[model samples]
Target chain A: MPGAEGPVGPRTDGGLGGGQRPRDRRRHILGDVFAVVCGAATLVGVVALAILLFDVVRDGVGQVDLAFLTSFASRFPERAGVKAALAGSVWILGLTALIAFPISVSAAIYLEEYAAQNWITRLIQLNIANLAGVPSIVYGILGLTVFVRALGLERSIISGALTLSLLILPVIIIAAQEAIRAVPDSIRQASYGLGATRWQTVSRQVLPMAMPGILTGTILALSRAVGETAPLIMVGAVGFIAFTPSGLGDQFTVLPLQIFNWISRPQDEFHVLAAAGILVLLALLLSMNAAAILLRNHYQKNRN
Target chain B: MVPSAPDLSFRSGRNRNERIIGAILFLCAALSTLVTVGIVGVLLTQSFAFFRQVSVVEFLTSTQWTPLFQDKNFGILPLAAGSFLIAGGAAIIALPTGLLAAVYLSEYAAHRTRRILKPLLEILAGIPTVVYGYFALTFITPILRSIWPETDVFNAASGAIVVGVMIIPTVASLSEDALSAVPDTLRQGAYGLGATKLEVSTRVVIPGALSGILASFILAISRAIGETMAVTIAAGNLPNLTLNPMESIQTMTAYIVQASLGDTPQGSLAHQTLYAVGLTLFLITLSMNVVSQWILGRFREEYE
Candidate 1:
């Protein structure tokens, strides 16, 4: 519709302003310019990301070493490290995966395999979709009320992990559902023909077949959960944690929280440290995403 | 399709186990519904308490957003203005570039190029928002200051630009799917004529995928609205009623984080204001997401 006039009445504009051959030549030039511009625009994001990585690496490379990784947050920016936040991030990621993975897989199994095509199932499906789209901050509010206050978990690592578990649950559920659905139904029928139970067919045949996809989804979900800050901020990830959290009940901060705190400070040294912290976070995220991609490629390769 | 029941020859023990697992799975599926109910209940019940103190009419009509100020004005317009301004600014940047990228990928790129570029774009999506926030505050704002000399260190412009870059992948991927959804036959038909690549993409593919393209726009805008960490770190926490991105302003989610991080006592008006704002944010994103999904599904064309 946009360029409809181009084909239908190419001569109209030409007739009004210029000769036909000149107009066609101008159009050719415009088309080439448009193509180049579009191509350049496509790479703008990639370029921006490259600049970002370069900027952080330049500012942070001097600060990243074994000491930086092992030290705790300090008032002196030079001495500050992300030990507490890194441990807390690990704790949250592990616990969120522990809490969310089995439940999400089971939910996907129910939705894709067991639940009949009824309004209840439809409602559940819609709810999950809507939940996935809800802002992560809202989940933080829910955690503050239900887990922190009602359940008396305090602002502990477990509470943060539980909140994040809810935040990533729908994503995992949707991804797991997609994976489960991709498993050939013929495999299910074959298992059934062997007198296997429904659960037997799913756990033994379907889940194993869908395992790589599930793993890919789980890694991606965890990567997202790891990077999130607002909900953790809302649920009380500390600005400065001097001690590494050793248990679920321990107080904690995460990499994003540490980065957020340092960035907000006025000290130039803190900003550099924040850049270093960002480098660490990005490294963690990149590894996770790389794992997901490798898993997906391997799955695709096997399928082919 | 599933043969309506399990094989009759399955052992009774396994059948019992299957039924239990099915029930467990059903419960797991129901948990997401419960999450929605919890979110709504938390937002509404707390907002109701807030409204009992501050009338709904005042909250909706007043422009001042000084909840923490001594005067204690609880109007949300200032926050809304900031959120929309950043969102609008982000849409301005992301929409066209992302659409162009999608068009290029869908119409021009070879299979190998697409395969590499698609995941490269996803790498942008996988990066943490806090890192974007850091880049916005440290990198983008300084660039803006060099350009204008008057841009505030924590202005909305840098936040918007980084947030825009952050969301480009979402827009690009979604729009690419929409454009690719346009039947290849249509593309071939256009090419069978003397239409140039630009003409075919602009006139045929874009128009055919317009609904889905618009859906991507809506989705991208919604994501911008709900984004927290970048806005929080770079947009500043001053709730002000203005459209200028050069000025620092607080957004709804940022205010929620600010409010939650404070020493606001439980059941106090300041504390309750968090939920009220959360409710408003929830409604806005919910409507946007619903509208996008409707457009994506309703106007979508399916072809083998």
Candidate 2:
């Protein structure tokens, strides 16, 4: 008890008469050591990330010249690039955004602004949350059964897009809901007082004010879609392709799938290509995240 | 009087347009719900079809998985066991490291330190899992092999380690959010009672955020289970029911990928088995997600 109380108090004197002071100093030293250890561990995580990025950028940027962006993957590594993958990724992103954005925003709006607090709304909310956690692979299974086989869209980009759309729908809805919820009620009340309909208030005032946040959420969801490989693989992304996909019905690959294909091969050179592909993928993801962050910051600033 | 009558009619037309927009928005919400239902319907139907072809006992209990071989044994146990082992190993590595890092960042690190560390940790998350797959195959596997010569070039240990690293960001970010949510008043009260910083954090704050922490861990496990590319790339496609982490193993996702990539003749028993395994994986992750949501909803500590 005496030793405990002494350490709890500040050490004003260098030595408070022998063993007690040494013990207190030892405890302080231990605390400092623990702090250093914790700090070092965090530093190590940062360094690991730095090394990863460095390796990716060094390898990927070199292969990211005009031809790399313009041409398709070939039988040889020297001729292989991410043209088809890039195009497929863009088509998927565009279609997913188109399909998910309006639906998610509307669902969020209905939940946040219009829907009564009833069992129906509760069921919708619960389902959305559960759907968010369902594995991407499961979505792929769904896509394979429904869109690919049932609808006869077999291994096409549209099926992949729809699958990705489903995968990110919950994300967009959640984000949209948060953004809508953050809009001050006072704004809504003021519009209501002025004889504006609920639709008018939402579209003219609420949606505009919430635009940045909605956009942010959309971008973040899209970023996740960009890197998604499991669902796409499940939905039947081709491992090798020599031509860019001309339509949604054409077989396609995304950057992540391309990276997966290259890395899976035994050749060491392909590993380097995988690293390069990762760099390109990372660049796309970072830019998307940056857009989201910018939008979030803008909205936060405006709110204040 | 004539001009006023015309203006009134134009305003009424505008109101009608507003009503149309409102209807469209409602349709969008309905579409989102329909998409979720569609996914569930499709997966269930295919999975049911798969079940009809193979007895549940055979699918669950068989040891060898030679779906494509002439002697074709349809037992899914080896793949399931391998998935669990790799995921379990990943959890062991991820949980401790991620939780410790969260504790340090939230309780001990300075603001400047947290600022640098948080985004750096996210960079790990941003690195696509395919890249992690390559890193595991090329970098970590070699290092592990040097220490354990018996380790297969493609083994569960390397896959688990890389997967754990892939999940660290997710666990750290969520746990940090939970730890930060602990009220400052609790810390102040603990300090007033002469508790150490470590004591205050470990005892009060951690306990206060227990539900969130639990939720985060569950989410991490769910992610590990759903993970495909890294495991598929690093862990060889051999579905052996061995407990050794240094041996080649296959996961449910990997099995699905292998079956899909190979000419597993659609409508064959082997193809149906893929859906059966997919069904099992889906159920496990879905249940985990439901548990997480239940824990989060039931135990969230609301602060004014």
lDDT winner: 1
Model 2 regions lying over 4 Å from their true place: A1-30, A58-62, A293-304, B1-23, B301-304
Which docking band does candidate 2 fall into?
acceptable
- Tell me how each candidate scores on DockQ against the true complex: 0.51, 0.40
Using Cα atoms with residue i matched to residue i, what is each candidate's TM-score against the true structure? 0.94, 0.90
Error of 1 at A19 (Å): 15
The digit string of per-residue lDDT tens for model 1 on B170-259 reads 999999999988887786676556555667788988999999999999999999999999999999999989988899999999999999
Candidate 2, A1-304: lDDT as tens digits: 5443343322324343555556656656665665566566566567667766666677567777777777777768887888888888888989999988888898888888777788877888888888887877778878877888889999999999999988888899999888888889999988878767778888888988888888987997898899888888878988788777888799999999998988888887777777877877887888888878887788778867
lDDT of 1 at A162: 94
Error of 1 at B253 (Å): 0.9
